[model samples]
Target: MTAGSSPRAVVRRYADVTGHAPVMPEWGLGFWQCKLRYWNQRQVEDVVEGFRRRGIPLDVVVVDFFHWPHMGDYRFEDEFWPDPEGMCERLHAQGVKVMVSVWPQVALSSENYDLMRQNNLLIHAEKGEDIAMMCWEPCTFVDVTNPDARRFVWDLCKRNYADKGVDAFWLDEAEPEYGTYDFDNYRYYAGPNVEVGNIYPLEYNKGFYEGQLEAGREGRIVNLTRCAWAGSQRYGALVWSGDVGSSFQDLKAQITCAIHMGMAGIPWFTTDMGGFHDGDIEDPQFKELFIRWSQFSCFLPVMRNHGNRSLSHPHADDPSLAALDAPHERLLKEEGEFKEVVRAQDGSPRFYSGADNEPWSMGKEVEAILVKYITIRNKMRPYLRELFDQAHKDGDPIVRGLFYEFPQDHRAARLSDEYMFGPDILVAPVVQAGARSREVYLPGGEETIWENLSDGQIYHGGAWQTVEAPLDVIPLFARQGKDQGLRKAIQEASA
Candidate 1:
C-alpha cells in the first residue's frame, strides 16, 4: 500500500489478505426482529403471527438466549419449547426464517459439561476456582480453537437446531465475556487468553459455518455475532456493537463504529437499533431516542432491531423465573436430584429480562414510525440485492464512509455522522435529540446532481444544504446519474 493510496485501494489490499466478503443472503438484506428474548414456544409463534396481522415485513424472528433448559444445553427445553419442529414449520409457512441464540459458555450443570471437561474442550482457570465465566451459573467457554471441540458443539447444534428447520445461529457471547476480565488467569486450547483472545469470534462463526456446510445446507451462512477479528468476514460473521447504552451519544458512536468496521475489513455490521441497555419503553425521552436510532438502522448492511428494553413489570410469566428461583432447579428436577442455588457476585440469584420490543410493543405513535421505516426498508429490497451483489463481486462495502466513495472530496474526509449507504444513496441520520433539521453534504463532480428522497428537491453536487428532518424523516439523497431504478424506489417509498 502506498502513502496516499485511495480508499478503494486500501480496502482491496484488505480483501486480498482476508478474502472477499461473503455474499449476504437475500433474507439478511431485509428486516430482522429480535430482543432480549421470547420465553416459550407459543410466545415466539405469537410474535411472528403479530407481524403478519400488523402487515409488517419481517424476514427473520430470533429466539434469544435461555430457550434451552440450561445455559449450555444445545437443545431446546422440552418443558417450554414443547415443539421446536412445529414452531419452525409454522414460521417457515409464514415466509419467515428462524435464528436461535447460542453462547460459548457451558454451565457446570449442563449435560455436556462432564464430557467436555473430560476431553479438555473447555477453557481452564490457572488460579483460584476453575470457572472461566460466571453468568447465570458458573461456567467455562468451549475451546473453539480446538477443531474437535468445534465439531462437538456443531454436531449438537446440527442435531438440535438444523434438523428442526432453524435457518441461522446467533453466536452470542462471542467475546467470551468473563464475569471478570482477568485475562492473565485464563487459558485456551490455542494458548493463554491474552495471547489468542481476538480469534475467538472467528472460530465461533467457523464452527457453525462448517457445520451448516457439512449438513448439506446450500444457502449462504449468515450468523449474528457480538465481536469479530480480522478474517471473521470470510465466515459470514455479522458483528454488532455490544450492549450499548440508550442515549444520543451511544447512537452517534454507532455511526463511526460502522464506518471503521468496514475499513477494517468486516463489512457486515449492525447495532441494537435503540442501544442495548437501560431503554425504558415507557419513557418519553427513551421513545424519542428509539425512533431516531431506528431511522439510522434502516440504511445499514443488515437492518435489525435488538436490545434489552427495560421492563416496568418484572413478574411477567417466564421460564427464566424458574432458573432465577433456583439456578439448578430445572436441571436438577430433570436429573432427579437437588443442588444449591447459583448466585452472582452480588449474592442475589442472577436473573435478566427485558420489556416487549416488537413494533407494537411501544405505543401506537412509536409503532407507526417503526412500521413506516420498515416498509421503506422492505421496498428497497431490489436496490439492496444489487448492493449485495456489488459487495460480493468487488468487495465494496454496502455501508461505507462518504470518504470511501469520494476520496478526493476534502470535506468528506471529516464527515463522520453522514455516510453512503451504497454508491448511490447518501444517508444523513439525525444523531442529536430534538433536532428538526440537519445539514447534508453531497459529493461529486461539477456535472453531478443530488435529489432529496424526502421532498424530491434537487441540488447540485459538491456543496452543503440544510434539510428538514421531522420525527419520521431520515435525510436520504440519491446521486442523480446512477441507478435510476434505486432512485425511483426511494422516491416511491418516500412518497
Candidate 2:
C-alpha cells in the first residue's frame, strides 16, 4: 500500500484486507422515516397512514428503542404495542419495510440477565459493583465476543421480531457506549475491553447478520447500527452518526462524516436527519435547519430522517410526566414494582419523548420541502440501484468524496462540503446558517462538463462557481456526458 494513494486504490486495499461490501437490498434505495421513536402500535400505523394520505414516498418505517417490555426482553410491550404482527402486516401491505431497534445492553432485571450472567455471556466489570453500563438502570453489555452470547440474543430477536414479520433491525448501542469511558475497567469473553473494545460493534453487527443468515433469510442484509469498525461493512452494517444535535454545524459535520465513512470502507451510511437533539419543531431556525438537512439527506446512500425534536413545553424534568409518556415504563414497573424507574441525575426519567417528528408534523413550509426531496429520492432509486450494483461488485462507494472520482484534481481532494453522489452527480449542500448561496468547486478531469440540475446550466470542470440556493434547493450537478438516464431523472426531480 502506498501513502497518499488514489481513493480507488485505497478503497480496494481496504476490501483486500476486509471483504467486499455486502449487496444492498433493493428496498433500501428509497427514503426511510424514523424518529426517536414510534412509541405505540397506533402511533406507528398513524404515521405510515399519514404518509400514504399525503402521497409521500416512504420505503421503510423504524420502530426505535424502548418498544420492548425490557431493554433485553426483545418483545414489544403489550400495553402499547398490542398488535406487533398486525402492525407489520399493515406496513408490508403498504409496501414499506419495518426495522425495529435492538440494543445490546441487558438490564440487571431483564428476563435473561441471570441466565447470561451465570453463563458468562455478559460483559463483566473488573473493579466496579459488577455493572457495565448505566442507562435507565444498571445494565451489562452482551459479550458479543462470545459465540453463545451472540446466538442467545439473536434467538430472542428472531423469536420476538423476525417471526412477527419485521424486515430488519436498527442495532442501537453497537458501540456498547458506556456511561463512562472506563475502558480499563471492563472485561469481555475474548479479552479486556481496552484490548478488544473497538471490535465490539463488528461483533454486534455480526450477531444479527449471522442470525439472519442462519434463519434462511437471504439477499442483502441491512441493519442500522450506531457505530462500526473496519470489517463491519461486510456484515451489512449500515452505520449512522449517532445522537447528533439538531444544528447547522452538526448538519455540516454529517457530510464529512459520511464521505469519510465511505472512504473508510463503510459504504452504507445515514444520519439523524435534522439531527437528534434540541430541535424545536415550532422554532423557525430549527425548521430552516431541517429543510437544509433533508435536502442533503436525499443524496446519501440511505435517506433516513431521525431526531428528538423538542416540544413547545419542556417535560423532561418532570418525573411523573416523563413516566406517563415514556415508552419503557412497563420495564420500570416490572423491576420491583416501579421502584426501578431509572431516573436521570436530575430525577427525571432517563428517556424523554420528543415533539411529533413525522414529515407532516413540522409546519407546511418544512413539510413541502421534505416531501419534494423525498420524491426526488424515490426517482433516483433506479440510479441508486446501479450504484449499489457497482458497490457490491467493485467495493465502490455510492456516496463518495470528490477525491474518489477526481483523484488527480488536487483541489477536489480538500473539498469536504461537496461530494460526488456516485460518478455522475456532484452534490453541494448548503451547510451554513441563513446562507442562500455557496461556492462549489467542480473537479476537473478528462474534459468534463457539469450540468446544474436546478437550472440546466452547464459549466466546465476545474473551476469554482457561486451557486444560488434558496430554502427549497441545494446545489446538485450531474456529469454531462455519462449516465444520461440519471441526468434526466435529476432534471425531472429538480424541475
Question: Who wins the TM-score comparison?
Answer: 2
lDDT of 2 by residue, 1-495 (tens): 323367787787777678666778888989898887677789889999999998998899999888765678888877777889998998999999999999998988899889888999899889858876777778878999999999999999999999999999999988888888889999999999989989999999999999999988767589899999988988998989999988888988988998988888888889989998878787889999999999999989999989876655433564555654565442233212222233333444535445678888777888888888888888777788888888777778888989888888899888888899898888899989899999999888648898887777898989999999998988988888664365565556556
| Alpha-carbon deviation at 233 in model 2, angstroms | 0.4
**Candidate 1 residue-wise lDDT at 366:** 86
Model 1 weakest lDDT span, ten residues long: 331-340
Off by over 4 Å in 1: 1-4, 313-352, 483-495
- Clash pairs, candidate 2, are none
lDDT of 1 by residue, 154-256 (tens): 9999899999999999999998888899998988899998899889888998898888888876456798999889888878888899899999999989999
- N/CA/C clash count, model 1: 0
Q: TM-scores of all models?
A: 0.90, 0.91
